[model samples]
Target chain A: MTIQTLNPAQRTIRTVKPMPLARNRFERMAWIFMRFSGLILVFLSLSHFWLQHLIVGTHQLQFGQTVARWGAAGAPVTIENVFWRLYYVAIIALAMLHGLNGFRQVAYDYLNNRGVYRGVMIAATGVIAVVSLMGLVALLGGATIVK
Target chain B: MLNGLVTTVREGARYKGESNQWMWIAHRISGLGVLLFLVTHISGMSFSYFNPKVHEALIEIYKTPLFSVGELFLAACLVFHAINGTRIALLELKPEWWSEQHKATRASLLITFVLGAPTLVIMAWKSLSFYLATGR
Candidate 1:
């Protein structure tokens, strides 16, 4: 018996395309960010729900009482306050990273031209930087930047 | 079947890159949106510990027009992030299941739209009504 093979002209070789430079570190950073944000959110969101909704009960909460608790400064600064601060900052940072990355994804999916892609990325980075810096200031105990 | 021309036209308009790249970006953005809203929500609720007066003040603010709008935006963020997140997860299920992935994503979005629209409407109505009744 003889093995039969196709002519060279009838054969073809295919190689998977390499990823573009535009999608290197940035994509990895975005993926890592989602996991980190998801983890933080699990704790922050749950604790928040427990503290405000379940423990206190929605109807029981009112203004003066709420203010007094935060105002009463002393030993350990209180676990609740600490949690609140951490929750706020972590959520803010995660949100900035996540949202900006999402926008990049949208641009990648929707935009067609190289020039348009670059332009969109620059604009996105600018917006993310400004918003994230503002969020950081607010979360770090500065005067509230957003109402 | 989806019209071949429609699919072709839509794909034609897509960015000259992998679909995964775009999906990856959107997942990040929506996740961040949820995070941002969560921070604001927790901080605002933190006021509840301050004093009843401040708490009431904050509640009234939430009921007011401006903050009410913000709350609606937050709700929008929640819905979009959740739906999009589910889409990303579905895509990662398995290579063998890849063919059905788009169907699942579309179904998820349909369900989201059905649920989200009514919920948002109710939330807005209730919030607005409470404000009017209180005259705050």
Candidate 2:
């Protein structure tokens, strides 16, 4: 009973069997997120490498350069840099979501107890959420670490 | 009350196990691995910024087999997660685009191979080259 969804890019996919007709379609959204994030990562990673390693040259990226680039007053913050930060956050966030969701799917298939399944989802989500928040804070706390 | 406490604890453990099953298992494991590497990688890279001598020294350490093994493992985790993730995403594609989700997954794998292989090679070469030039 696999369900198919249409994408803006005109692609189609056969996914898990649709449970109820009026479900919130959360997994569908998660699936979309993975593709978009993956596509963005391709660009973000490449640009980051090109900028830090190729354009500026790897040797030149000192603390001064890093600080300058981030706090360049009005340098427009280049698309690459903005994407770099977003890429970091997005990959972490999406990876967690995709992975956790996959775990849930597997548990649903193999684990017999429905009660156990719900419990697992809650626990997994809680751990992932807390850790992700901590990671975000650490990543944003550049001043303390970078200097 | 004693029974309740035991039940609560048992339920808690069950939930943790349940949530971390399957793809989530891979996700958590890989996520943790990547995160750990990222922290070390940043710190090591920071050496160059704070002090060139230290930075070069850290880079030099990368030449050893241990570092290579770590890098290889990191690459493997990254590639695996990326490819499988893309497959899942392809499974959500519209019916008009692909008659079957499995087909989409296969195509996604193709794309993954195309991108991942070159990136891995470049990363390895660059890292090795850095170590070779500076015997720090």
Q: Identify the candidate with maximal DockQ.
A: 1
How well docked is model 2, in DockQ terms? 0.09
Give per-residue CA lDDT, model 2, range B42-128, as digits (tens). Answer: 556434334546656675566565776576667656665666555554454544655565555556557756866766676667666
Query: Per-residue alpha-carbon lDDT of model 2 for A1-147, expressed as tens digits?
Result: 466668787767777755764454766665566578765554554455445544554433454555443333234556655655566577566555655665566555545567877887788777667666654553343222232
lDDT for model 2:
0.56
Worst 10 residues of 1 chain B by lDDT: B46-55
TM-score of each: 0.53, 0.50
Q: For candidate 2, list the clashing residue pairs, or say none.
A: A5-B94, A11-B94, A12-B93, A12-B94, A12-B95, A13-B93, A13-B94, A103-B24, A120-B19
Q: Candidate 1, residue B126: CA error in Å?
A: 3.7
Model 2 chain B: weakest 10-residue lDDT segment is B16-25
* Cα displacement (Å) at residue A81, model 2: 6.7
Candidate 1 chain A lowest-lDDT run of ten:
A138-147
Please write out the lDDT profile of model 1 over residues A27-113, one tens digit for every residue: 776676665565555455445544553345333445444433433333245666565556666766765666666666656655667
- DockQ scores for all predicted structures: 0.14, 0.09
Any runs in candidate 1 off by more than 4 Å, and if so which? A1-17, A20-26, A35-76, A111-119, A142-147, B1-63, B66-70, B90-122
Query: Chain B TM per candidate, please?
Result: 0.69, 0.54
